[model samples]
Structures are given as C-alpha cells and as structure tokens.
Target: MSTSRFLPALRVMLALQTVALLLQAITAGLLLSTPGGRGLHNASAGVVLVTALLYLVVAILVWRPGGGSPRAVAPAVAMVVLVLAQAMLGALHMKALHVPLGVLMFGGSLVQLVQVLLARRAVAA
Candidate 1:
C-alpha cells in the first residue's frame, strides 16, 4: 500500500473544503449581519453541506489502504455528524447553536486541511 498514491487528490479535496469553508463563513456573516441576502446565505449553506459530503468521500479515499492517514476518518466522520447537527440547528432556528457550530465546522475543516497538507506520507512497506 503506497500512502502517497492518492495524496495529490486528497490535498486537492482538502483545498476545496477550505474554499467551501470560506464561502460558508462569508454567508454566515451575511446571514447574521444583514437582512437582504437570505437567499444567497441559504444557498451557500447548502453548498457547504454538499462540499462537506464531498470532503468526506475524499477523506475516506485517503484513509483507505494504499493512501492517506487512517486518522483522517475522524475528521471525515466529524464533518458528517457536525453537518447534520448544523442542518438541524438551522432548521430549528437555533441561530445561537447554528452559528457557533458553523464556526466550529469551519475550524475543524481548516485543521484537517492543514494536517493533510503537512503530513509526511508513509512509505509503502
């Protein structure tokens, strides 16, 4: 199993996740700070959900044999779980929880992205 085989793809996905995080962050701010862009804000939140799912798929890809770190599964699962809760928070109009949770999600994704980018791939044994 070559750990480096899928590294590039994993990195790309993580980067995309970061971009999605940025978009989500901006939308969240707009949602809270202004009243004129609810549509775009909602759309961005949906995009964040979709991107999180995409990130999970890539995370699983990296965690599989012949690829990235097994520990990546943690963040992958966390993203799914967190996103689900985030959706629920939004639906319930729990802005207090929803906003903070979104921040947490963004931070988690950022941390995972950094870890992926900085990792030294294991040499195939």
Candidate 2:
C-alpha cells in the first residue's frame, strides 16, 4: 500500500487526539475548581483514553510493513499505556503522579503529532 494513502487517516487521528487532549486539559482545570466538574473530568479522561487508543490503532496500521510510514510505533504504544496509567492514578487519587503524568502525556502527544507532520513533509519534499 502507498504511504500517502494512510496520510489522511493519520491526520484525522492526530486531529481527534489533539482535540481530546485539549478537552482533557480543560476538564482538569474544571475538576480542580468546580464542585460538579468531577463528572466532566472523568468523562474527558475517558475521551482522552479512547482517542489515544484509536490513534494508536492508526499508528500501528501505518507501521505495518505495507504502510511505508516513517513514524515510530513504540511512542504511539507508550502513549496509550501512559494514558491508562494516568487513568489508574486518577482513580486511585494519586495526584502526585497523576498530575505530572498528565502533563507528560500532553507533551508526548503534541510531540508525536509534530513527528507525524514532519514525516509527512519529509515524504512530500
């Protein structure tokens, strides 16, 4: 399969994950300040996890030998695992780890998105 064929789908995955990450951040702020924000925060956590998983799936598809993608597979998988851990930390009320890990995940996802975009540019050029 052509690598370019997967580009659009990969881009969509990146877009969804970006939005989910933003929502997750907003919900985190809400959770800290609003009494009723817990529900929204939890719901947004689920969104982040779900989108990360979906994004990973796409990454794996692109990583398949046939996909010809330059993106690394390990980081995508790690992000999924980290998100799961983040959820567990939140559920167990491990703020010490949860808060820091959330920040890490935010940075990681943005980095991954940039990598994908850079790969696309490199391929096009």
Candidate 3:
C-alpha cells in the first residue's frame, strides 16, 4: 500500500489512543471514589495499551514506506513505553508516580493527536 494510505490509519489510531487515555483518566477518578472504579480503570488500561500498540504499528508503516517522518515513530514508541510503565505503576499501587505519569500520558497523547490532525490538514491544503 502507498504510504499516504497509512496516514489516515495513523490519524485514526492516534485519535483512538487519545480517547483511551482520556477515558483512563476518568476511570482513575472513579477508582478513587467508587468500588467499581478499579475494574473500569483496569479495563481502560488494556484499551490504552492496545491503542498505543496500534499507533506504533501504523507509525512504522508510515515511516517504513518513506511517506512519513521518522519523527512519528519516536513518539509512538514512547507512548507504548509510557503506557507499559503506567500499568506497572498502577499494579504496584504507586499513586505518587502513577498519577503524575497518567497526566503526562494523557497530555502527550492529546498533543500527538492534535499534531496528527494538523498534519493531515497541511497535507490536504
């Protein structure tokens, strides 16, 4: 497939990742106040991980075919790593690190999503 085809896929994956991260944050709040919160948070963690991996895969596809910037790969990799670390921190009950890292992940994912959207507009223009 042409590299351009991967752009749409990449954008979709980034959007998914961003949404998943946001849901994770919401569930984290629920986790603090409700008995069902922990289960929802835990499930959302899996969604975040899956979306990150999908983003990484699309990033590689975009880069490997010489259609996209290699820079995209780095952030995708970082997202995967950050999500894994976040999962571990939560599992270990390290709220101090987990909370801050979750915020960072959500912020970063949002930024990445915006970048991808802007890039698409730039391409279309």
- In model 3, pairs of residues that clash are none
Look at candidate 1 and tell me the lDDT of residue 27. 78
lDDT of each: 0.75, 0.79, 0.89
Q: What is the lDDT of residue 105 in candidate 1?
A: 81
State TM-scores per candidate.
0.82, 0.88, 0.93
Candidate 2, pairs of clashing residues? none
Model 1, poorest ten-residue lDDT window? 116-125
Residue 1 lDDT, candidate 3, scale 0-100: 23
**Residues 1-125 of candidate 1: C-alpha lDDT, one tens digit per residue:** 23656667767777887788788778767877888667777787777777778777766776775465677667777887898898888889998898888888888888877776556444321
> What's model 3's lDDT at 29?
93
**Which scores better on lDDT, 1 or 3?**
3
Positional deviation of residue 52's Cα in model 1 after best superposition, in angstroms: 1.4
Determine which window of 10 residues in candidate 2 has minimal summed lDDT. 65-74
